[model samples]
Each structure stands twice: as structure tokens, then as C-alpha cells.
Target: MFSNLAIDVALGLIFIYLLYSLLASIVQELIARLFNARARVLTKGLRRMLEDDDHSGDLGFFGRFTFFNFFYELGWSVVYFFQPFKNSPFLKQFYQSPAIRYLGENSAAARPAYISPAIFSQTMVHLLRGPHKDNQLSDADAIRECLAQNSLQLSADTLAHIRDLFEDARHDITAFRLLLEAWFNETMTRASGWYRKHTQAWLLILGMGIAAAFNVDSIAIARILMKDKSVREQMVQLAMSRQPQYAAITDTLIRKNVLHRDSAFFRTDTTWKVMVRDTSLIGVYGMLRNDLGDAKNVLGISRACVTDTTATGLPVVRCGFTHPYQRNGWLIAAGWAMTALAISLGAPFWFDLLGKVVKFRSAPPPNTTVTGE
Candidate 1:
């Protein structure tokens, strides 16, 4: 009844709104880019101040893209990160944990968390030993053995979960050290059943981690903490709601699988622990298990020595650490390299595959090509 004149006026108003929104978005992007540029410039300057003139331009790239790095470079970075088992995968997780943001990609700490654990541990060692920080002994070979023996006893699937745990920590690897220490101290003295101690510790750490994640000003913590559980649940459900082709590889690692290491850590009743580690606590648990019973099967890793049995009650916990299918440096590198190469070389095909995996619901069909105009 109002005719096309009314429609014309409405279209004009819509166009004006669109223009304003576009301009605002563009300005916001420009300001963000400017800030990023400034931060990178300052980062370069600061490193030069502390380290050797950073003679290698490649170091900056390594510094920047170490996480999500291809297999070979990642291995080297892991080596340079820690002198002990730089050749091993532990370094990758250690360095990459302090500031990782599994919940948010854009966080600053995410990059550091991407670094290998070897680098972070070594860096800590250097700072501590450099006549300025703690005077920790450099007997990393012993420490590596302790952790290695411990890690090897774990099941392959359990090791996979721990690997994911490292990525999840990409926003806050530093907290790992505190938590790891807490794990040792708390694990040793607590008289409660191991499960109860574990429940309490995981809850405490998860609560703090989630809290930090949501505090906007906190570098390690992002906003995921404040989000309603419903929101987080929905987000996770949304991601996993799909039946992707890659689901086969992940099926063994899913939380509820009996063989999955996380299944044991989670089978507990606490809500906080269930959510925090989600499905990735097997990092150490699977390794600690010494018994494979008739009923069911289930798990330090450190570089320090404790030969003074009288002085220290136990330099090493009795967790068995001898058996597992070991995939050392070369094999590990080749596998990751294959994955990267697949995605990089077949990016378009992968994108198409991804599209198939996520079959998004469609909107209602448009009324007309010209619309209300």
C-alpha cells in the first residue's frame, strides 16, 4: 500500500548505515595494524639489548613463527631451545606452554607458547645459571632421563593428549613451571588418595588459568574465563559437531575412550577438572602407571638428579618409564612435515575438504536479486 517510494527511502537509509559501518571497520583495522607494527619494532630492539646483536635475520622469523612451524625448523628450534633433549619433543611443549591461548588465536602470548619446551627450559636454565638468577646445576642429562623414563611408560594415545596439552598452553607456558612445581610439591606431601590430590590440584590450576584467560589486561589470560559455561560448551560443541574426515585420527584421543589417557584423569566427578584440562592431562599421568592389571590398563619428567637419597626422600618418583613405541626426531619430523606439506601444497584441496567437513546450515533464500529497492 505504501508503494515503491517508501521502499526507496528504506534502501537509502540502509546504504548510509552500511557506509558508516564499513568506515568504522576500516579505521579499527588500521589502528590495530599500527599497534602490531610498533610492537614488532620494539620487540626487535629489546632482544638486541639483551642478547648478542641477534646477528641472524632468520632468528626473527624463528622468533615469530616458531609455533605452527614446519617439522625441520621446529626440530632445530627445539634443539636450540634446550641443550638436554633438544632432539626430543618435550622441549616443543615446554617452551610453547607459558603464553599459549587455545581459546584465542590473536593473543600475544600465543606465539611464545608455540615455542618448544626445550627452549623455555633452557632459557630458564640460562637466566638462573647466568650469575643473575637461580644457580641450578646443569646436569640436564639426568633430568632428561628422569622425564624420559617417566614419559616412555605411557601409552601412545596418552602421549598424544599430552602433546595437545602443550598446544593448549600456547597462551601461557610460564604458568606451567609454577604448576609443574606445584604438581611435584603437592603430589609428594598430600596424604589423600592420589586421585583426591589430583582433583584438588587440577581444579585449583584450571580455575586460576581460566580466570587469567578472561582478564583482558592479563597477557596470558584472555576472555574465555568470563564466558558462560554454556558459551564455551556451545563453542566446543560447534567445532566438534561435525563429522570430518580427520575424525578417525582423533577418535582414539577423544575423552571417553577407555584407552584414552584423559579418560582416567576425567573419570573423576569434579566439574572444574573436567573442563580445564578438557581431554589432555595424559601428558604425565599415563607415564606414571606401573600396573597393567587383569581388569584394565592405565600412566616427572625432570632433568635434575637426586643421588643424595638421605638428603632428599626421593630424587625420582617410582613411575615406570621404559616401554612405548618410540618415534624419535627423524620420524617425528617426517610425520609433521607430511601434514604441513599436505596443507601447504594442497591448501585449496584441504579448504574444500574442510568445507565438506563443516556443512554449515544455510540461511533462508533471498526474496529477489534487486531486493527491497
Candidate 2:
């Protein structure tokens, strides 16, 4: 089992894995850098607009990005309130309500709602302050009454206070909406200001600059997305005709030819190499075809083939307590270890490691265990 092919495959996979990881990190860094610079440029523009005494209601770049993000997040919080499956239902109204209203429902997490500048709708901001002229009740009371209307009960004091705050709630809603409209006007003016300041930059992008930027960003995103699990699977399936039983041992083949270049689309006959890294503590396994073209599945290896030579050609593989993760890149290391383990210990040792990772992904744990589930 300690064959040259297996060693070469494993070494290739590990190298590819490292390279892919580095590239991914670099892309992420680039995005972060751009985001921060973009945010700063916007912030500076907004500050300039806000400083102009004669400037109309406008927030500029700073208002749109820095301020908008906070406000948008504030609005998004309200979305949670509207979420059908969310814990609190009365608060659904607050997702559109100002931050004060949001907190009345969830005091621990609430913050002020900022106005959005997209369609220019926000006009009422008075409701967001300490006390609007329309105040009729405390924040706590309005939410409690709303909840009670929906059948959720509260303490006697909560009930009494809500009965008093009816007018405040009504006025508060109006004021909140008005704040958004007014803020919208200001932010729009600010955006206009930013444009005036960076007109040259804007023109550059509008001309050939944007076109090049589009190409660069598009290429980076495509590369990042191509590295996904689904893409790798497709590549393997496409290459099945030529590289028979290619599952565990051909990552070098896959990475060098198929993946980054999308050779599957052009090359009719080839093997696909892929690398799998365990990103979560929760054990998981996913199937990937070993070829880059749509040929017959030559790499017969699968989680089920743990006890046999499997279509991929060599030994059976499994995931177990010890071996929690497996990937094309690790195949060389795994194959040799298995070969040695088989020689000195037994097949179960290798099979167990592979078994754990495979079954977990197949019979995945409850939502709690899955990342971003």
C-alpha cells in the first residue's frame, strides 16, 4: 500500500491545500482592506457634507456606508421581530420602529434605528429622541400592551403602564417614520456632496477603471467560489471516464489540471484532484467525484467502500474516532498510514477513522452542530 503513487498524491494534495488556503485568506484580506478603505472614503465625504452650513440634507459616502450599515442593521433587527419563527412577535412592529422601540421589546440587545438613503423615504426622526412631544406612555408600556393584545401576559404593573401609554405608541410610530424621511434627505445631500468631491474618481470608474475593477473582482470571486465542495464534486464526475477509481488518490491530478482551470469543460479525458479540510469540530464528510469531466465514475471509492478496494483502485477507506477528517490531499498520508497500520495492526484502525467523518456528514447532526445551519 506504500506506493509511490499514493505518496505523490498525498504530497500534492497537502501542497494544494496549503496553496488554496493561502489564496482564500488573501482574497478575504483584500475584501477587508477594500471595505475599510471604502468605508473611510465614505465617512470623510459625509463629514464634509455635514460640515457645509448651506448643504441640503445629505450624508454623502460616510452617511451611506458607515451610517447606513448601522441603520440597516437596526432595520434588520426589526426583521427578526417580524420573523414568523422568532421568539418575540409583538416586536415585529419595531423592526420598522426606531431603536428605542426595538429595545422596549428586547432591552438587552436593542439600539437606535438609522434612516436608509436608498429611495428617500425617511422624514421623521423626532420619535427617536429621549421623549417625543407625542409621548403618552413609557417604552416598556407600549410593548407590553401590544404583547397582551396577542395573548402574551405580563405582570400587573406592566398591564397598568401599557393602558396609559397608548397615545405615546401612536405618536411614536409617526415620529419614527418622520425621522427616517428627514435623515434620508440629509443623507442624500451628503451623497451628493461626496460625488462632488470625488467626481474624478467616479469618472475614472465609469470609464475604463470600473471595467477593469469588475473583471478583477469577478475573477477573484469566481476563483473563490470554484473552490467550493459542489464544484469539486462536479469536476470528479466529469472526469470519471478516464481516471478510474480516482476518488482518494488523485488530488494532484485534480488541482494541477481540473479545479483552478476548469479543465473538465475543455479536457475530455483526465483525472480530478481535490483537497478536503476539516473546518469544523463536528465531524462531517461529503462525497466528491474524482474526475473533472462527465465520464463514468471511475474512482469507485466511497464511504461504503471502507471494506473493499473501492472503484478508486487501492484500499478501503473509513472515518472513525481517530481519523475524523479525510480529503484528496490527505490521501497520500492516509494511504501510507493505512498500509502500515494494515501491516502492523489491522484494517479496522484505518476504517474507523474514515467511518466517523463519512457517517457524520451523511447523517449530519441536528441544526445546532452544523455551522451556519
Candidate 3:
């Protein structure tokens, strides 16, 4: 029973962390939207490819048009279903024409919001080749002429790499395109790493904020759960009830709105449209409320477990807010820090740990009675 109780406490703590992490993610997304962080990062990356130190002029008309169009179209497609942009009148107006809407729907499968190296290479090649000028020039000359005309700058190393590829491909357009795609893939990989690093930094900052707001002190919660049998039992039951629904809800969210490759968020397909209609935090909370009763009941359990109080009344339990100047201030700070760090581990990590703990709780107890001879 003690072992089972300990597992329950661990699971409860993990569940709280997971919720905090999800809230942090939602907040981070909101911040990104408010600041247009994605567009800014994308523009910075594109500029590196389109501008050179030596050729410090604005891109040619065609170059500007192609790049800006790509940015606008990709931005609309990616963010159209996100909460921050879903109801934009401008996007609605842009897609009002049936023909344009149909084209957008059809092309969505081929164009993810995140610009890949392959996509970049393909777009660049198409722009460089231009309209109705197919067999007019060698691939190498066409690439060089396109860059020169656009006043685009490339680093010395990148220029040398392209020249080497041109020689190796013997100016074969297809071969050159493939080489460029490979090079672009490498570049995008590095860019992705940078993006992820910044995202983690944002998540950590948000996690700390959420921890403070919720007063999620891990040490206090652990002590309360270990000592209070009733609270522990109630929490374990709540977790058990909530665990089965977690995967279904999360999977639906990913399939309908989160995954870039899925592209189901804005599809005209009736089934997909129905599935994505309620892909919001409120929707998920509603589902939980329907299954587990009031969402506040669950939150109350977590709050009661972590909150520090000074009451010395009967049925006493240590939980409630603690001030930094209090006698145990350092301990409270450590607990808050631990909670914040757990949230930074992200929701999936806690979900997995909760699953394992639940399985452990469900296992049959060991037999202690000896068999009669």
C-alpha cells in the first residue's frame, strides 16, 4: 500500500507538470503570434540566402516578388488555423474566391509552413530559370546570371561550393538541382537547431512564470501526499479516471491542428472540418469536465496538495503559499525551482511517466502468506 501510494504521488506530480507545460506552450505560441516571431525568423533566414555583402542593393523586382509571395502564402497557410490568426478578416477575404480557395486547398499538401531545403532549392531554381527561357542557357550560367540580376550575395564558401557542384554536374540542370537541394537541407537542419534552442529558452522562461502563478511547489506537494492518505487516494482516483482520455484528446489535436504535414486544419473535407472545430484548450477542458466532472475539482486537488498555510487547526496539512522571508524560505524556493524545471521537460515526458506509474499501481499485490505444508 505504501509503495502504491508513493507511485500515486509521483504520478500526480507528473500530471501537474504536464498541465503546466501545456499551458506554457500555449502561452509561448501566443507570444510568438503577437510578435510574429515565426515570420521574423523566416525572413532573417531568407535574407541570408538572398543578400550578399558585396551586392548590397535591394533584390530585383522578380526576386522580391517571388520571395515575398512565398513568405505571404506560406505564412497564411501555416497560421490560418492557429488560434491567433484563425479569424483574420484579411485571410478570409484573400480566400473568398472559389478558384483561389480550391487552388490553396490542392496545394496545401505540397507546401508545409516550415520551409525545407528541398522547397527552397525548388523555388530558387524555378525563379532562376524564369518563364519560357528553358533551353536558352547552361544551368551554371543561368544560376550565375540569376544571382547577378537579383543582386543577391552568397558567401565565398557557398559560391565556391556552387561552382564545384556546377563543374561536377557538368551543367546538367537536374544534377545541379539535386546538389542544391542537398546543400539546402544541411543549411535548414542548422536553422532548425537554432529555432529549437530559442524555443526551449522561451519555454523555460514561461515555465517559471506559470510555476509562480500557480504556486506549484513540488516539495510541499510531496510531503502532503505522503502524509495525507485521503488526499493521495482521491488524487490517484482522479488520475486514473483522466488517464485514458489523455491520448485520444492529444492525438486528435495533433491530427486536426498541430502537425504541419497533416494539413487538415483548414481542409474543406467535412470530416476534417468537424474534427478540428473544437481544437482549442477550452475544448479539451470541456471534454475533461464532461468525463471527470468540474475541472476545478481536479485543480483544487493539486492546489490543496501544494499550497502552504499557517493554520494550526484540527486535521492539519501543510499546503498553501509561502513567502520568501519565511523561516523555510529556501526550501520553498527549491520546490518552486524544481516544479519549474519539471515543466520545462514538456508534457509528453510526464504523460509517459504517468502511464508507467498507473501500470505499476494496477499490478497485483505480492502474496505474503506462507503455504501450509
Best by lDDT: 3
TM-score of 2: 0.18
Give the winner by TM-score.
Answer: 3
Q: What is the lDDT of candidate 3?
A: 0.55
**Residue 185, candidate 2: C-alpha displacement in angstroms:** 31
Tell me the tens digit of each residue's lDDT in model 1 across 278-316: 223242223212111100110001122234344557554
Ranking, lDDT, top scorer first: 3, 2, 1
lDDT of 2 by residue, 1-373 (tens): 1223333333223222222222222233233233332223333332232222121224456555666666754564455334422433222332334532432213432322122332112211222222433548554444444545634332344334333443444646454345444544555455544433333233222323322221112222223224444534443223222222223323432343211212211112211112123231011111121121121121212233345577888786664222122333344344433322222221122223333333333353355454473
TM-scores for candidates 1 onward, in order? 0.17, 0.18, 0.63
Candidate 3 residue lDDT tens string, 166-281: 66777777787888767655655555555555556787888777666666677876776777777677767777777877767555545644312223112233222422342475
Candidate 3 lDDT for residue 270: 20
Worst 10 residues of 2 by lDDT: 280-289
Q: Cα deviation in Å at residue 237, candidate 1?
A: 46
lDDT values for all models: 0.29, 0.31, 0.55
Better of 2 and 3 by lDDT: 3
